[model samples]
Target chain A: MALATLKNVRFAGMATCVPRRILSNINDCPPSLRSERERLVRNIGIETRRICQEWQCLSDLAYDAANRLIDQLGWKKEDIDGLIVVTQSPDYLIPSTAIILQDRLGLEHTTIAYDVNLGCSGYPFGLHLLGSLIATGSVRKGLLVVGDKSATIKDPLFSDAGTVTALEFRENSNPWFFDLNSDGSGFKAIMLPVGGHRNPVKFFHLIPSEDEHGILHLPTDLILDGTAVLSFSTQRVPPAVEKTLAYANKKIDEIDYFLFHQANKMINETIRKKLRLPEERVPSTLKEFGNTSGASIPVTITARLREKLTEGSKQLLLGGFGIGLSWGTAIIKVEEACLPELIEA
Target chain B: MEEFIEKFQEAVDFQDPVEVTENTVLLDLPEWDSLAALGVIVMFDIEYGKTITGDHLLKSKTIKDLFELTVA
Candidate 1:
C-alpha cells in the first residue's frame, strides 16, 4: 500500500484533446462476428472511439491540451516550474516527451521535466508525484501531461487521448489524498509481450496466431486478459478506494462524483455497484474514448463531467486501475474554476 | 448451482440448451471459446458472486468443475 497525503497543492485546471477521426466498432466488425457485435459493444461500452490520424501522435494531443490549459489559466510559460508527461507511448526512446514538450510549449529552460512510463493507473499516480513536488516547494507550479495512442493498430480495444492537468501552490490548506498500489507479479495480466529491452521484437514476434474467434494478432501486439483484469478490479479497487476514503476522512455520500478509469462497461459497473454509487454520479467515456491508457481518468473527466465540474466546486473521488496490475485512488476537492473546456484536436 | 447448466447452455450457444450438462466437457462444445470463457467469468461474478480468473476457467475441464469453483 503506497499511500500519501500532501497539502497546499490543488488541481488548478484540466483540459483534454481527443482526435477527430472516429472508428465505429460496428463497421470494424467482420462477417463472422457480426451477430455478436451488439452484445460485445454493450459489454465493452465502446460503440465508437476517436482514433488519431497518421500524422498525429500522443505528443500532439498532449501538447494541444497543455497549450489550451495554459491559455485558459492565463499563466506565463516561465511560471510553469515543472512538466511531466506520463505515457507508455513516446515519440522516441531517447528524448523524453517532457523535454520535447518543454521546448514546444515554450516553458522556461530551468523547469523540471521528465516522463513516467505507466498505463491505466497513470492519472492518480501522476497526481501523486505532482503533489510530492509541490509540497517540497522546489517548484511553485507544474503541468502533468498524460496521453497515449496505444491502439493504433487493428484492435478496437483502445482509443487515443491526451490530458493536461495544472497543479499549482495555493494559499488554501486543502489536502490532496492518494492511495497507490502495484502488483508487479501480475504485470503480464495486461502488457505487450515484445518490443521492450527484455524481449526485443524478432521475426517470430511478427508471426500471427489465431484465437478461437479467428482473430489474428502478432505476438508483439498488446494483450488483455479480460477475466484477469476484471478479477483484479473486483478484488482490489473497492478496498483501495474505501481505505483511501478513510485515510482522507471522507464518506461516500459526501462525494459529488466518483470518476473511475474508463476501462470498459462491465468492470466499472461491477465496482460502481459494489461501492453503491448511483449511475448518474459515475461518469464513463468508454463509449467515446475506449480505455485511453493513463489518460482514461482525465479524458473521462473532460468528456463527461466538463459541465458539472466547471459549474461549481465539487468533491471528487478518482480511482484508476489496470496495467502494472496497479491501482490508485484519490479524494480531493475540485473547485469550479479548476476545470477548463474539453479540447478536441 | 442447479441453474449452472442452463446458464452454460445459453452462453455455450449449442443448438439445444438441453444438451448441456454438468458432465459435458467445455472444449467439446463448438461454442466453447475465449468469448464463452469470458462470459463464464462474468456469469460467475454477477450470478454466483465469485471472481473467476482466466486461468481458473481454463483449468476447469467440465461444467461441473467450473460450477464447483464458483462454490469454492
Candidate 2:
C-alpha cells in the first residue's frame, strides 16, 4: 500500500511534443502479417504512430516540450527549482538526461534534477515525485519532463514523444492522492533484454527472425511477453484502482475522468469495464501515438482533453500500468486553462 | 450452449465464414493462428466473462472445447 496524500502542491500546465515522422503498421507490418492489418487496427486501435528521427533523442523531445510550456506559461527559468525527466530511454549512458535538460532548459544550478528509468508507469510516478517534493517545502516551483523515443529502434509496438508538466507550491492548493505499486517479479514481462548491464548488446545479439506473420524481431529489440503482460494488466489494474480510490476516499462517479495509460484499446477498455466507467470518461492517445511508453498518459491529455482541461477545472483519476511491471493511480485536479495544445517537433 | 457456437464463430474470426458447432475442430479453420488465438482469449474474457490463458486456448481443440473452457 504505497499510498500518499499530499497538499500545498499543484499542477499548472502541461505541453507535449512528438516527432513529425509518422509510421503506419499497415505499411510497416512484417511480411508475414500483411493481410491482418485491419484486424490489428480493430483490436489495438493504433492506425498510425509518430517516430523519432535518428538525430533526435528523448531529451530533445522533452526539452522542446519543457521549453514550450515554460514560454507559454511565462515562467522565468530561475523560478523553477527542480526538474525530473522520466524515461527509460536516454541519450547517453553516463550523464543523466535530467541533468542535461536542467542546463538545456536554462534552469539555475541550484535546481534539483534526475531521471527515473520507467516506461508506461513513469508519468504519474514522476508527478507524484515532484508533487511530494513541492509539498515538503524543499522546492517551490518545479518542472517534471517525461518522454521516450522508443520508436527509433524500428519496433512498431512503440511510439515516441515527450511531455513537460509545471507544478508549483501554494497554500490551500488541492491535495493530490496517489497509490503507486511495482512488482519487480513481473519486470521480464515488458523489457528490453539486452543493451544493459545484465546483457550488454553483443554483435550476436542482432539476429533477426521473421515470424510467420512477417514481423521481424532482433535479440536486442525489446521483448514483450504479450500473454503475461495482458493477464497482469487485467488482474492488477482493477484492484490498484479500487485501493487507490479507497485511499483517496472517493467514489467512481465522483471523479470527472478516468484516464489510464494508453497501452492499447483492448487493455484500457477491459480496465474501464472492470470499473464500470462510461467510455466518455476514459480518453485515449493510442490511436494517434500507438503506445508512447512513458509519454502515453500525458500525451493523451494534450491530445484528447485540451478543451475539457482548458474550459474548466476537472477532478481526474489517472492510472498508469506496464513496464517495470508497475502500475499506479493518482487523484489530482486539473485547473482551468492549464493544458496547452499538442505540438510536433 | 447453442448460442455459444455463434459467439465462438464471432470470436475466432475467419476470413471465410466457416460454420462452427460444438464438434467443429478449431485447427481446421483458416484464421486459427497465434494472433486469432489471442483474439479468442480476449473474446472469452471480455464477451463470455471467462478469464482464459493463451496456453488454455492452445490446449483447446474443438469450438465446443473453447465453450467448455468458458463454462469451466
Model 1 chain B weakest 10-residue run by lDDT: B9-18
Residue A196: error of model 2 in Å? 1.5
Tens digit per residue, CA lDDT, model 1, B1-72: 568888766554433344767888888876576656766776777677777788897788988898898779
* Superposition error at B57 for model 1 (Å): 2.0
The DockQ of each candidate is: 0.38, 0.44
TM per candidate: 0.92, 0.94
Per-residue alpha-carbon lDDT of candidate 2 for residues A1-345, written as tens digits (9 for 90 to 100): 499988998788999999999998777666556666667677778878998888999889888888888888888998999998888888888688999888888889999988888889887799899998899987899988888888843454689898999999988988899999999998888888898899998988888887766556788877787777877888789988899888888898889988888887778887888778898888887887899887888898898888888888899998888998898889998886467678888
Query: Which clashing pairs does model 1 show?
Result: none
lDDT of 1 by residue, A1-345 (tens): 477888898688899888988888778777777666755776678888888898888999988888888988899888999999998888888789899989999999999999998888889999988878888897899999988987654566689899999999886757889999989999988988898899998988888989767888788878887778888988899899999999988888888899998888778887888777899999888887788888988887887788877888889998989899889999888886566666778
What residue pairs clash in candidate 2, if any at all? A30-A214, A32-A213, A32-A214, A33-A213
| lDDT over C-alpha atoms for residue B44 of model 2 | 77
